[model samples]
Each structure stands twice: as structure tokens, then as C-alpha cells.
Target: MAWMYLVIGGLMEVLWAIGLKYSDGFSHPLISVLTIIGIVTSFYFFSRALKYLPVGTAYAIFTGLGAAGTAIIGMVYLGESISYIKLFFILLLISSIVGLKLNAKVEA
Candidate 1:
């Protein structure tokens, strides 16, 4: 369940990140509102997951997932160029998150 929340939070992080591009520095009211909602909801789930997961481990995983997910979305939907160097770093980030999840023993 904690992992589920973490995944949802990561996805919300992606939404908020993409929302920023459309926000026009918060000038676009609708997207700005959605961005705020996304950020708030993302943090709520992240905080909930922290109740059962270690802070250091959970936070690292959360941010890593956010960064990687947002980068992928930007590349695919926003047509942002994904260079080989950036891809390598993103893969490294994913590996680190997976390692932490595999190594950490979170209680339900």
C-alpha cells in the first residue's frame, strides 16, 4: 500500500511538472490551479507513505521517481530532446531507486 502511494505520488509529481510548462509562470489560471492541486496531492501521499517507510529511503525514492518520470514525460509528450548522456543519468537514478526499494524493509 505504501508503495502504491509512492507510485501515485510520483505520477502526480509528473503531472505537476508538465503543468508548469503550460502555466506560463502561473499566468494560465486553469493549469496553475491544477498544478497547485497536483503538488498538494503528491505531497499528501508522499507524507502518508513516510508513516510506514523510513524518511531517508522514502524521500530519496520519491524524488528520484519524480525526476525520472517527469523527464520521460517531457521527452515523449513535450518533444524535449533526450540525449544519450541524460538517458544514462536517468537510468542510474532508476537503478538507485530500485536498489533502495529492494534493500529497505518497510513495515505495513
Candidate 2:
């Protein structure tokens, strides 16, 4: 359950990130409002997960998903380049996130 919340938070992080891109430095009213909403919702879920998960583990996973998801979205929808180097690093980030999840032990 905690992991689920964490994952949702991470996805919200991605939405907020993309929202920021469209917000034009907050000059765009609708996008900016949605971005703010995303931010609040993301943090709410993140905090909920933190009640059960280790701070460091949860935070790393949260931000890692956000970073990787944002990059992929940018490439797919925003005309961002997907070079070998970028792909390699994105994979590395994903690998590290997986590694952290595998190593994390939930408190009993």
C-alpha cells in the first residue's frame, strides 16, 4: 500500500514536471494552476508513503521515477532528442532505482 502511494506520487511528479514545461514560467494560467495542483497532490501521496517507508529509500524512488518518466515523456512528445548516451543514462537511473527497491527492507 505504501509502495502504491509512492508510485502514484512519482507519477504525479511526472505530471507536474510536464505541466511546468507547458506553464511558460507560470505565465500560462491554466497550466500553472494544474501544475500547482499536481505539486500538492504529489507531495500529499509522498508524505503518506513516508509514514511506512524509510525516508531515504522512498525519496530516491520518488525522484528517480519522476526524472526517468519526465525524460521519456520529453523525448516522445516534446521533440527532445533520444541519443545513445541519454538512453544509457536513463537505463542506469532505472537500474539504480530497481536496485534500491530490491535492497530496501520494510520495517516490521
Candidate 3:
């Protein structure tokens, strides 16, 4: 399903994003290679999902999911801050993505 692909892409986006932090500016060869693989896989799924989903809707959902998921991963795994305001915005992003997905279903 397109939604499944989109979610996988989002997860890969999060993986690469966190991996980037450990890459030491790409000096860490293993982490850098993993990061590159993650990014490529993320785009591959994203592009595949676009074949069935509208570009505007799919892209918005993809980036929103990536941003929110990556932020949560950073907070939990990387011990980044999780302020009330930041939490509120993340929730907003999730809501927006859900709304877009619902809209896309209705459109189809």
C-alpha cells in the first residue's frame, strides 16, 4: 500500500537523520554509509508512494512524518530536549499528516 511505503520512508528518514549525528561529519565511514543507504531507501519508497498518491498531499505527509518521527527519536534515543511547546508542535504536525491522509483517501 502507498501508506505503508510512506510510513517506511518516514522511518528511514528518521534513521538517516539520527545517523547523521553519529557520522562525525561523514568521517565515520560505517555510519556515513548507513546514512546514505537510509536516505536512498527513504526516497525510493517516497517516490513509489507518489505513483498512487497526489504529489502535494504525499510530500506534505512524508516530510511532516519525517520531522515529527525524527524529533521524537532524537529526544528519546539522543536525549534531546522535549519542551511543552515542542510537543505541542509535534502533535500539530501529526494531526496535519492524519488529516491529509484522510483527505487523500476521500479524494481517491
TM-scores, each model vs. reference: 0.95, 0.96, 0.94
Model 3 regions lying over 4 Å from their true place: 105-108
Using TM-score, rank the candidates from best to worst.
Answer: 2, 1, 3
Candidate 2 to truth, TM:
0.96
Query: Of 2 and 3, which scores higher on lDDT?
Result: 2
Candidate 3, residues 1-108, lDDT tens digits: the string is 899999999889999988898998999999999999999999999998988888899899999989999999888888899899999999999999999998895124
- How far out, in Å, is residue 103 in model 2? 1.1
**lDDT accuracy of residue 96 in candidate 2:** 96
Q: Give one digit per residue, the lDDT tens place, for model 2 in 18-100.
A: 99999999999999999999999999999999988899999999999999999999999999999999999999999999998
Which pairs clash in model 1?
none
Whole-structure CA lDDT of model 2: 0.96
Q: Could you tell me how far off, in angstroms, the CA of residue 48 lies in candidate 3 after the best superposition?
A: 0.5
lDDT of each candidate versus the true structure: 0.92, 0.96, 0.91
Give the lowest summed-lDDT range of ten residues in model 1.
Answer: 2-11
Better of 1 and 2 by TM-score: 2
Lowest summed-lDDT stretch of 10 residues in model 3? 99-108
Which whole-number lDDT from 0 to 100 does residue 98 have in model 1? Answer: 97
Candidate 1 per-residue lDDT, tens place, 56-107, comes to: 9999999999999999888888899989999999999999999999998788
Error of 1 at 52 (Å): 0.1
Per candidate, the number of residue pairs that clash is: 0, 0, 0
The reply for model 1, stretches above 4 Å from the true place, is: none
